[model samples]
Target: MKRSETFTTVLTEAHAGSRIDLVLSQVFPEISRNQIQNLIKAKKVLMNGKVPKPRDIVEGGEEVSLEIEIDEGVSAPEPQAIALDILYEDDDLLIVNKSAGMVVHPGAGNPNNTLMNALLYHYPPLKDLERAGIVHRLDKETSGALVIAKNEETAEALQKQFAERTVTRVYQALLVGELISGRTVDAFIGRNPYNRKKMMITEYDEELEENPGKEAITHIRVLERFREHTLVECHLETGRTHQIRVHMQHINLPIVGDPDYGSRLKIPRKFTHHAENVLRGFRRQALHAYQVGFIHPKTGEDVLATAPLPKDMTTLIDAIREDHELYVKDHF
Candidate 1:
């Protein structure tokens, strides 16, 4: 899947003063400036029969040949004897519905007892696959469908599709309040200067905006509304750090039980709308990656997987319903 595409631009005086990276950015915005520099370093980017340096100035009407390298991206972790849910498994790939509260992979302080640990224990052969066995990730709190790579080749393909935003992931959340009937929180998001741990809606400033992140789009629609809660469905256009949670908070409606970005609503820990809101005793972010769809890495065939709400989420929903119903009957 390593394919190369070319672009030839007639650099005008408009492009003369700009650096090669900036100049190409205007011509080829789909590719990043760093990627362009990578081609130059690899001697794949030539200007007038020579490898033009990064800072080199391009004159008007110069032909720039770019031999871009395209590879599907995949990531893996240190292999260990991790026991996986193993909803589906084969030689090429597998799909598993992660439970709530399980960290997807190993990280600071959580080196063991993670999804990676279970995965490692399940697929000892994945030692060679590395993160290739881990194609997509679910946040430690968010539970739902994830695709795992069995080998390096499958990992690469899944990574590429995820990077290009071709994969479809659907997350359901219970917000603190009733949201607009149908809404899309279309706003630019930046890191919180005040808190390194959070992303927030940032003001527009040249200095802060220069190297800002790309467009993050979210489509949200209210599914159900209780007295003080709103169940909503979210579709993500770009997968940035905490995209759904940040966008929801940016609009002043954070997910129920989300520690960092959620608006604090005074409710019992029993929250969330998963399991179609039928159970009780649920806590956590109240967000679930319920469904995922994509093309199979090797077969290129459409694939879709759905995960039901975990017991914790379902239990909480049912408890809330019974509690509220009883309260209303007694009060009336």
Candidate 2:
């Protein structure tokens, strides 16, 4: 389904000298700045019946009108009766604990048995939403809480929160090396120029170059440290592809079991057999989206969700702790 909407607003003196796109985004908080810019580029927005540039300054008393055609119904994927670890659900949205190895949506080589498929099976109405109401996504090997909107309005609202950087996301990971203290990684992330499959942390100004990358930031706090590994909590300031993994690797702390960014398979000579086995056998990135918090799109209330560590990670941490204790006793 598709529909058209028209909105008109009169600017005040306070808005004078601001860019048209910026002013419109402030006027319509639910819509994103990118969307507003796209509308301007497409000539769907008019100031006194004339298409205005995005950078055009807005003056007081100007009549701004915006007309846009939105696709109300999105093409949904096939519904599959896959199980979902649902944490919270309401009329507006749902919070799900996405398990590792589960792809959030269908892509090349994976067309079924995804979270989107399962969502459609449980809520048929989601078929009308974009990406089956998935406002954000978790990588296939990352496990944790994720938000799914129930309708277009809610989806747009939640998406705006993400764009505005108002949503909070915290992840837990076991990096390969011991980190003494907390640190922040502020860099630009872009697909590797040599290998498109991997992400690289480039200079912050890389965004001004070809194949521009987006700004990415991750704050890491050491939770526990072992002789050979560190368990840390990561707070994402900007969400980008392979953000945590790439940022950790940038600091030479690539996550354990991360096939793409992990260090070569080598165990410390002094490590216990069990600890070595746990690290060697791990098959996926030791990263989880443990917590997510955002404002409710409909109720305007703060909503937070947390997911417990999966069994594999918990087991690995236990082994690391035991090995560290034994090593300390022997050395002392």
Candidate 3:
């Protein structure tokens, strides 16, 4: 059987005068506004102890409540026989290497067959915790090492580590442009005005409907450089939505194959035929979270996990390397 979990919050001056949907989105950044609206439609959300429409305006100090239905066993997201690439595991936590194209949670369009489903199957006990004991997430197109806490106490401890910005997250990204050196980008990231589905680096404007952007900082280091592409390693100091993609695009070095932030495909004249084919075939961002580290909640020892590059990315890099060598040899 399932149980209902209730979450309640009060709007502050910072969120004053915002639409209810927008206010709820800011309060629960993990869930999308569309999902919040869906909850409202299901009569699972209340404002000031009354059901409110999504467009209702909110003033500071108003109480809002959201209810979510979850099970003590495999519930709405029925457990499936999906295999997880286990990286490290203990009684307190489990680290898995999540493949690209795998959704971490169920949402509007994706209601099942997600990592959450697989986790429930792997360890049914996770069904009792929020988000199946998952404390963090990776985008569907971003492959990476992810950590999952196993119990309520451990979940709280893990969440505190992430909130304090103590968790170490490292990624490898293939960019569309070349870089002579590494750089650190400190910018504000907010929803794109023209495209609500995308994020961008922008300044806050009082007149615009957009909420004030959050600070995002990424430290980039060039690892290898091709004629038209650069492979770089990024360390995140603050984890904002699409932080790397937005920061890279802001620097005019959008990631290769990033559908939203990438530029139009421009094959270099000197690129070999194979390189062009690989670049054209890629449909997802060339981004991978290679490593993650945190202090274990129970053991009180540091834990680090690393994921190897996926085959597609490895193949892409190989094609680029061959093209670079051929170009250099032909010119010199």
lDDT tens digits by residue: candidate 3, 81-100: 89999999989889999999
For each candidate, what is the lDDT? 0.70, 0.85, 0.88
lDDT (10s digit) by residue, model 1, range 104-212: 7666667667887777777777667644377666778898888988887787677667756788988888777667587887776655767765667655569633444
Instruction: Provide TM-scores for the models.
Output: 0.69, 0.78, 0.81
Candidates arranged by lDDT, highest first: 3, 2, 1
Error of 1 at 288 (Å): 0.6
In model 3, the clashing pairs are none
Q: Cα deviation of 281 in candidate 1 (Å)?
A: 6.1
Candidate 2, after superposition: displacement of residue 56 in Å? 10
Better of 1 and 3 by TM-score: 3
**Alpha carbon lDDT of residue 254, candidate 1?**
80
Per-residue error for 316 in candidate 3, Å, reads 0.4
- Name the lDDT value of residue 119 in candidate 1: 75
Global lDDT of model 3? 0.88
Residue 52: error of model 2 in Å?
A: 11
